[model samples]
Target: MEEKNMFCFQCEQTAGCTGCTGNTGVCGKKADTAQLQDELTGALIGLARAVDDTSAVSKKTWQTIIEGLFTTITNVSFDNAAIEDMIQKVRAEKDSLVGDCNKCQSPCGRTDEYDMQQLWNADEDIRSLKSLILFGIRGMAAYAYHAYVLNFEDPEVNQFFCEALFRIGYAESMDELLQTVLKVGEINLKCMALLDKANTQTYGTPEPTDVTLTVEKGPFIVVTGHDLKDLQLLLEQTNGKGINIYTHGEMLPAHAYPLLKKFPHLKGNFGTAWQNQQKEFDHIPAPILYTTNCLMPPKSSYIDRVFTTEVVAFPGTVHIDEQKDFTPVIEKALELGGYKEDQTFTGINGGTQVTTGFGHSAILSHADTVIEAVKSGAIRHFFLVAGCDGAKPGRNYYTEFVKQTPSDSIVLTLACGKFRFNDLNLGEIGGLPRLMDMGQCNDAYGAIQVAIALADAFGCSVNELPLSFVLSWYEQKAVCILLTLLHLGIKNIRLGPSLPAFLSPNILNFLVENYGIAPITTPEEDIKVLLKQ
Candidate 1:
């Protein structure tokens, strides 16, 4: 690997509001690791394009491609060795495809890997469009990885990962890149659907459940991020060990799944969102197992207690390998011995508990009553003001926006962003809480299902419904979800904590002109505008 500073603008935390061209990422990724990630991405693209046909890509090749893309995602992996190993696996996969390239009479030049520098220096428009595709598939791979672990796989979603990576390296013009960009959204919709099916089928559909903010006195483990499989395994390993597991961040909604919730020691949720972990986990007598994204650089107070598994890694943190044994996480909880008494914590708004599990099944079960209430004018309009929450000061916009919604309007939410207002007692309409927690970030699928179902009930398209999406994005998953919404032709979305740095003026204008996507203004102003629309 080169010993030079790396350039990466793939995420929200890029340096100086542009790219990270330094020795370390704002998220704490070291310079050498960034180079390896870029190298891995380049090799994967070459492997993807080199195969003469789709069938020529073996199962191992596909696995290598998915694992490679997912690992490069921001805050997902920090181990240079692990990244180096994955890069080698990808290269080995490529070598198998290019076997006897020199001996063959028909030599294909497509086997060559395109340098990532080319895309980085390309015209801003082409760069933005291709970034959307590459980043989208990276996010989608997390969802696909979860489903595959549970034995659910969709061939189309799998195929697109290869195709999009291939295009990212080779697509030359704006027109060619734009096609793959939109298709990222389209395929991700399928990928998220596949994950939804896998989760629901394996764990049973989620139901409404109230999660407490209090931590029980004893040995306890706090699980964070988007992986239910990791959480489930931990629950099993810690079951009879006198330890309790509390969900945090994106893992909060795991409490709703029938199979996961069945664990007696699963207990309740701990912290508000990923952004609060540095404060919440400090001096806490428990281990935080990060299974996926939104891993902030750990603090010294709790650094030793934080263990990462799967794609989530921070250098010097104990990494649980593919064996998935969470013994370290369990042992750390025991060593800390927890609090002397049951600790009562409150949400940011001081509520004692938050409610989740308002997934598609639960919401649609009450669909007729919801439609009746809408017809009777009991509910004025619906606002879907949810996505990834961040540590930025302005992110309080979501809390204020949710608070300012008309009492008659129902607020639907998913992902960590809901933590902003999830603990608030927003009351209810027709027996359903006005602010409904629609599971995790992956449960964006459930939110989509509910939107489509509502549109069907009202004899209109989803865009024609009274619902409006006010989304806050911080990572690649949010990017993929945004693309999925655009692919479905949903319009008038409001995005913020500032628009992505990746979007050039022209690319952003293309979005604004074509889809009516705009950044959030003041909550007071945007709510008034959206309500009128």
Candidate 2:
């Protein structure tokens, strides 16, 4: 590795709104931290190559791949030692697969390793296309890992992950790279479908739920991230303990699940998005548990009270290991005593209550009503205001975009970014709430289902339908979701607060020319363009 200052501009809030080409990221990642992440990525590529054509992939191989990929996500794992250990595990798994292949003589050519630098420095267009395949797959992998932990695994989805990784390591042409990019969308569709099945099967299909903003008085714990299993586990452990659990960030959707909401103590949502955690958690008298990423480093005031479980980690915070013993978090919540009196908090829009659980099943069931509303002009336009949240100031565009949308328009949002405006009460149009929260980031799967259903009902393609996607992206998971949208040939998406640093101009041009991708301008201008289209 070159011992120069580090440079990374893959997210929306890059340093100085350009790129973080310095000793640390604008988000606080250090130089050594960036290199270790690179090393881990390199090792993961190697592991993928090692399994290139193997007849069988063991549980250990899949586990190593999932953990390794998760570790490279923006703020998940920062410890060099942990990443190094993961790299060793990848190498060991590769060696075992290699040894098995040596005896067969008929090399399956299935497993092999990749060096990610080729992607970092490829021709601009090829790099952009490949980056889409690579980063998009990375985001999709997080959802797959989450679903897998809940005992739901799709073989085709898993196999495509390995295949995509293998191509990223060796693919050499624009056409090949472009094909890989679409394949990512195809595979992610299955991955998202698998997660949907897992979530619905494990925790019944979500019904329309009215979640309150008031957190009951008592010992309470706030759980964040998109892992339903962690939420279920915490709910199980905290049951009957006089502790109320509140969903935060991506955990907001847990409220809609019948199995999860059955717990009376499982109360409503706490804060807004993950980016607001530091300010939101300050002086809060409860333990905050992070089941997954988008965790910013905690301040000392709430640092001791913050606990991480599963793959999420921060150096000084306490971690709840595999045993799922949340006793420490529970003890901390009790010690904090919470609020002596019941407290009422309002959402961003001053709405006392927000509704969720309008997933694919629920939305599709109402397709006829929705189609009629559009035909009758009760619903003028549909806007999908969704994607990741970041520290960029321009992100306020989402809030303004939703705020300025016509009352006749419906705003459908997904992911943590929606927290910015999910609290806003846009009122209703034609009996449907003007704004709908479609679960966590993975619930983009649900949003896609709603889009396709609407398209079918209206006898038009998804793009020809009166729907516009105005998205805000911050991490790799968003990358995958965007790729999926592109794969389906959906066009005219306005993305912001900033575009990914990984996309070269040529690749961006391809997206612009082919998919009509554009950076978000002013909310006023974007709304006008969207309405005109």
Candidate 3:
């Protein structure tokens, strides 16, 4: 048998402008790890078909399916051990539904593990639709996982995972697969909503919080990714241990949550975007904990001190297992001891602090003021300039785009992408900050809520409410969010640092024609076009 290398095109940085058709992925995923991820995805699909066949989807089975798909997402898990472990869980779930294949009298192919290569080599249109369903579910699973961590699980959302994954492998016709594609978007809205509720109900509705870029002296730990529960656990473990906790990447918005910020030792943020971690973390004294995806392969300089928990694991890094004790992370943080003197850091723009926590409730609390300003012409438009940030060069377009927004416009942002311009100080209008950081990308739910409230207050459709979405995407989370926006009939959206390579020309054209989706151009030209509209 010919040796298998790897085949993955899940994110924005695939090779050859389409798929990772070589030994390694653009994200630095090794060939063996990539193939293992494919196997995991295949196993999850098989598990889904099994769950559907039996109609007995246990909570454990549901979680296995969700986390398995999420693990296969780009930059999520690079550990062959972790991927193989998850594959076993998925395979075990299938076995639980139906006994060993060899022991069964009739071997039905309904629940057989479909080789991922089949979908990869299918007709272009069918492959595109199936990829959308698979990738979209993978993204939504991240939100569901966060919610699950907080003990919130929606049966509808969980069931959809099985339904969508089942369709990915078994659904044949283009028309059949199209429903699954849209359903991924429709279901993701619920997933994000569940996460928003989980976060607010558990952590308290996020408030307007101004977080500094300064990292105090002494022992400290940098927590990154989107899992609040992991951050909370680390905070609890390190509370009296003399270790300061600082949020990084998507975890930055954790400071705005009342429950998270209550710990006095939970200090300010560290580093910039996830893509910048390699350079930023070089020679750093603190151990960083990755709670979720968007993890680049750790560089050797700091890999020894890097800790991963939940589904995030990178080879030699210490991984906090099911107990989630985080003692290893704590020990490493204390071992580093941090800088001798207090060090104050600034954002890429040289701003010492950035404001966050303008979640749905916070923004809606100022609805009257916001509406009055718009009525008084003090605020002319609202620009939602946010999404996943990447290492891609042209991503600076987001910074330029936000800088060019009219002074009267209220800019709402969320996710790691906001780092591109979150510190630019766009000033305030109607007593509210002109540029509001509305939590993480999952808080796109919060942005949606705020937009709906604005539209309702003004008695107009969301798209008619002087709001525009100019998003930058690098991963599947953005894909699910974009699909949700489209499902809601929002129009004239701009997405860039280049659209997904997986999007076939026909699919891209369909989106453009139906939803007015377009790739972003120069900020000067695009800003003028959006402002005029």
Cα displacement (angstroms), candidate 3, residue 454, comes to: 1.3
Model 3, 245-328: lDDT tens digits are 888999999999999889999889998899999999998998988889978888889999888888988998888888998878
Shift in Å, residue 280, candidate 2: 0.9
* TM-scores vs. true structure, each candidate: 0.97, 0.95, 0.98
Tens-digit lDDT track of model 1 for 361-467: 99999999999999999998999988988776689999999999999999999989988899998888888899999988878888899999999888999999999
Q: Backbone clashes in each candidate structure, one number apiece? A: 0, 15, 0
Q: Rank the candidates by TM-score, best first.
A: 3, 1, 2
Query: Using lDDT as the measure, what is the rank order of every candidate, best first?
Result: 3, 1, 2
User: What clash pairs does model 1 have?
Assistant: none
Q: How many clashes (backbone atoms < 3 Å, residues ≥3 apart in a chain or on different chains) does model 3 have? A: 0
Q: In model 3, what are the clashing residue pairs, if there are any?
A: none
Give the lowest summed-lDDT range of ten residues in model 1.
Answer: 50-59
